[model samples]
Target: MPADAAAWHAWQAHQHQQRQRAAAQAAAARPSWTRRLRPAPPAPVRAATLVAALVAGLAFALLLGDGMGPGLALAALPAMAAAFTAARAAHRKARPWTLAWVAGCAALLVIPALRDSAWPSTLAILCTALLGALALHGSRTWPGVLLSPLGFADAAVSGIGWAWSGLHAVGRGSKERWLPVAKAAAVAVGLLLLFGTLFSSADAAFADLLGDLMPDISLVDGPLRIVLFLFGALVALTAARAAAAPLRWDRIEVAPGTPRSRIEWALPLILLNLLFAGFNAVQLAVLFGGYDKVLKSTHLTYAEYARQGFWQLLWATLLTLAVIALALRWAPRGKPGDRRFVRVVLGVLCALTLVVVASALRRMDLYVDAYGLTQLRVSVAAMELWLGLVIVLIVAAGVFGARWLPRAVVGSAAGAVLVFGLLSPDGMVAERNVARFEETGKIDLAYFQSLSADAVPALDRLPEPKRSCALRGINDELSAAGDTPWYATSLGEYRAREILRERPVTAPYEVCSRLGSFGSRIEY
Candidate 1:
């Protein structure tokens, strides 16, 4: 029985060898073209690359669209879509949360408020993509989440590396085979250009038609487009690849051989905290006291008073953040007393900084009230608010320790960006300024007219005469678009154009006093 079993095993092994030999011979027999020029990348890489390329193309096409805001919103679709396409390519099985993240991103894109503000729209798309990638890869680590952008950027480099590797894998002899084709193509292009130019120069009618057909490509813009396309493609590809294989943060935290003494870190923090406390006390007594108190303390007008310290306060908050980070880095974590004191100082510092944040926000509010909101003002306000939130989180970290601090900070910051983006700052600014005009019976017509399509919806809400005057520039530009193709249509531009069509501008004003590139062809 043992002899018979051994013979059977030997027969099976021989059969396996025969099959492998036959498969190898068949593979070799196949024509060179029948095989891939390079080994096909894994399914995920292929899918991600193709999807990213397509989306990037779409984004570029969208840039030629009518309104800056909607055009930007549409352009960000590639980044958002990459998260979904990459996840589908990588994992065979996906969680419900992954789907939710993708869905949430799609929902945000469609919301009118988010679609009309370029900055907010772009930020929201990035946040959504990052969140989606995280969910798909099952990465919840704070450090990794915070470093998502770097990972995405690295993925592009990795892809380029892969390309290099594939090229190296191709035999050197293969290059000779394609050399003739390359020469032929180059010769053909040169001959065509030479002949075409000569033919056009010899015949006036041909020259006229050729000149009409050719696009006016400037020396700068012609090269610039190609460069931008290549860069954008690389970025999109990297983002797609990163979604599939999320980078993990696993650095070993090495303790310093000789830690600095507590006094070195604590003394500065204590002094800084004391200074902040004094400032906060003053802010409470004067800044938050009352309009009358502010008026009495500073002889300057309300706007001037509000404007005085905002830039300074902003710089202080940023500098304080840097100081805290440096202090924590050097401060001894091993000693319980040292750690406790450090935490207390940080908490107090963050608390005081919040007061500074509040004062900055108050100043910005007062200034906006007096002068009316602008993109710069709104953006600064939102940024300061986010900073204040970060400070709160820092204080929480001091109390609770750092286990979830990184994730909380990243998530909160992302949330803040999304919230602000959804708020449609441009439209909000326009709406507020229009309301201010109604109250004060004065408006900054120049500023109002300067706003982009994000302000269109708000401008549409205004009563005539003011509305007509406000939209005069926009309407002229819209008219000068010369029947834009459907491919370049945008929500903001479409809405603005429709409003103008419905309510024709009766006010007399120079059409596009400062004509943009798109409107330059029209006889103004």
Candidate 2:
């Protein structure tokens, strides 16, 4: 019994020592009291750190917004780099494609700065928004492509969430970091003001120097700048966070599709194909017969016949693209017959659409030939040509290509726009109008005068009276403008000013004098 009692005591003692040792080790490994008292940083606090860095970028972009040139291009870099980095950090798995997407977006945004064309800039802004959607969903289907605008909207919402979350995190830790910084800033400012006042009172020279150095800060302007800073910072931060944490569009539930029989799908497609074929047949006759047949059939003049069909055909082409996209999405793809029917019908529709596009182009050419070429007409013509290219791509992809069709479509559209931008639409409009006037002996001096500086070189090619009138008209219009900042001054306007300075001023001719100024104020 005595031995047993001793053994039990030893066992109990060993267990006590083991518990003591564990408690000691755990206590040693535990965090300090200061850390324990501190609030846990929020998940979105990292986004706050990112936003702080982006504030500097936003300021630089704002500063550079004054001019469109290398400055604008340089301004785009900070936002581009920030977005790319944030996206990578948020989604490491989405690295490869994200890099390409961001790079493409950056290039598109920079083109307008380099080329100084409105169309490219508009396209670039659109492409950038689309890329933001692409970054989030990582899909290239109809839902992804079509819902890009929605995705942008969702990103804005998500960004607000992130910013609020970040602010919460910052609030919780304000005592730790923010208070110190605020206190230091306050002390520094107070000291500067106190010393500044003392020096001003002590020495008139110092006061004069100080007064000269310190700009007159307008109360209204100062507040406006502050407001702008906050606005810009919020926007930049929101975009950064949203890019890092993209909203998934696939989460939105869609209704399950009811499958249709092959006949149900084939009949409509067949009817549509027939309608398109009939239109194409008529178009062929009209195109082959020239504007004469169009005038005869419509019982109208060449301009009326051409003008009426151009807009209608453009709408038809756009509607056809949408229809094809929908058909591809919901049409029966499970059965061989259905697939074959879709492929054939869509292919034929695309081919016929190409014919329509060609007819439209022919009509636009006739109209431009009769009337003078304007920016709208030229842009529309370019679009018509692009539509034809899209149709050809659709036909080729449907027939021969199997994969990457969406990418091909996107690339082709982008390529077309890039080519058009490089072509310089303003210059083309000027050249074509000048050439037409030269041949037809009908020149609208007012129209030529209204053209931007891109048309200057082309306008300079005209004969003496026309050249002098055109230059004078443009110079008069440009010179009468109200004061504008350097950033607001476009490349076209700058070049036009240069042209005006370089060329000699010519007195108004009888023709130039007879036509009164189109603008309201007759400063001339």
TM-score of each: 0.66, 0.72
Stretches of candidate 2 above 4 Å error?
Answer: 1-69, 91-96, 115-120, 157-228, 253-256, 287-299, 396-413, 472-490, 504-524
- For candidate 2, the per-residue lDDT at 406 reads 59
Residue-level lDDT tens digits of model 1 in 151-264: 555567766654333233322224444466569968998998899999998999998777654433456564555654566566566656655555544231335445578787
Could you tell me which 10 consecutive residues in candidate 2 have the lowest summed lDDT?
34-43
RMSD of 2: 12.6
State in Å the error of residue 63, model 2.
2.9
What does candidate 2 score on TM? 0.72
lDDT for model 2, on a 0 to 1 scale?
0.64
Q: Name the top TM-score candidate.
A: 2
